[model samples]
Target: MEKQILDFSLVPLGLCLLLAYHIWLLHRIIKHPTSTILGINGVNRQVWVRTMMEDVSKNGILAVQTLRNNIMASTVLASTAIMLSSVLSIIMANSKARPSEIVLGAESELGFWIKFLSILVCFLMAFLFNIQCIRYYSHASMLINVPVKKMSSSHLRAEYVKRTVNRGSCFWSLGLRAFYFSLPLFFWLFGPIPMFLCCVVLVFMLYFLDVTFDYGGVVDEEEEW
Candidate 1:
C-alpha cells in the first residue's frame, strides 16, 4: 500500500513538474527570444543561413557539409532511440504477467506495464522527432546549395531555407528533450522516490543550461533577429 501510494502520487507529481518547466520554457522562448539558449541559437542560425545564401557559389559546399553533419547526428540519435524502444518493447512482452515486490513502485502488474510504457513512449517520441529533424535538414541541404540567382528567380526564398534549418534544429532539440524526460522515467523503475528526486535535479540542471546569462558578452555584435 505504501509503495502504491508513492507510485500514484510521486509519479504524477514528477511528470507535472517536467511538463510545467517545458511550458515555462516555451513561454520564455516566445516572449524573450534572447533570454533562452534556444532563442539565442535560433537567432544565430538565421544569420548563418543568410550568410550562406548570400554567396551560394562560395559557401555552398560549406553549407552542405554543415547540414550533412547535422543529418548524421540526427540519424544516429534516431537509430538509437528506435533500437532502445524495440528492446524495451520486447522485454515488456516477454516478461511474466506476475506482479513482483522487487520493483520499488506499485506491486501490481498494471503499474509495471504503465512504467514500461511511459519509458517506451519517450523513446518512440525521440525517434520520431529525430526523423523529422533529418527530413528538414535534408531539405535545407538541397535548398542551401541552390545558386542565389536561381533561388531568387524561383518561388524558393532565403527565408524559407532559414526556416527549414531552424525547424530541423527545433526537432533536434525536442528529441533531446524526450531523452531528458526518459531519465526520470527510467528512475521510476527503481522507485517513485528516485524518480521524483531525479525530476527535481533534472529541472534545475535544465534551467541553468537552457537560460542564458552571458548573452550580452558573447553575442554583443550580432543584431537582434
Candidate 2:
C-alpha cells in the first residue's frame, strides 16, 4: 500500500511538472523568438535559406551538403530510437522477472507493464519525429536550390523553403526532447522518488540549455549570412 501510494502520488506529479515546463518553454518560444535556442535557430535557418536561394549556382552544392548532414543526423537518431524500441518490446514479451524484485508500484505486473510501455512510447515518438525530420530535410534540400525569383508564387517562394527547413529542425528538436524525457521514465522503473528527482534535475538542465540570455554574443552579427 505504501509503494502504491508513492507511485500514485509521485508519477503524476513528475509528469505534470515536465509537461508544465514544456508549455512554459513553448510560450516563451512564441512570444520571444530571440530568447530561446529554438527560436534563434529558426531565424538563422531562414537567413541561410534566403542566402542559398540568392545564388543557387554557387551555393547549390553547399546547401545540399548541409542538408545531407542534417538528414544523416536524423537517420542516426531514428535508427537508434527504433532499435531501442525493438529491444524493449522483446524484453517485455520475454520477461519473467519478479515484480517484487524490480518494480515498486501497486500491482507488480501492472506497474511493470506501465513502466515498459512508457519507455517504449518515448522511443517510438523519438523515432517518428526523426523520420519527420528526415522527410522535411530531404524536401528542403531540393527546394533550397530553386532560384527565388523563379518561384514567384507565394507557396513556392523562399519562405516555403525556410519553413520546411525550420520544420525539420523543429522535428529534430522534438525527437531529442523525447529522448531526454526517456531518462526520467527509465529512472521510474527503480522508484517514484528517483523519477521525480530526475525530472526536477532534467528540467533545470534543459532550462539552461534551451534558453539563452546572450543571443548576440552567441551569434556574431558581423558574420554575413
lDDT of 2 by residue, 63-82 (tens): 99999999999999999999
Per-candidate TM-scores read: 0.91, 0.90
Best by lDDT: 1
After superposition on all C-alphas, the RMSD of every candidate to the true structure, in Å, is 2.8, 3.7
lDDT of 2 at 183: 98
* Segments of candidate 1 deviating more than 4 angstroms: 95-106, 152-156, 216-225
What is the C-alpha lDDT profile of model 1 across 11-48, one tens digit per residue?
89998999999999998877677888998989889889
Q: lDDT of each structure?
A: 0.87, 0.86
| lDDT for residue 9 in candidate 1, whole number 0-100 | 98
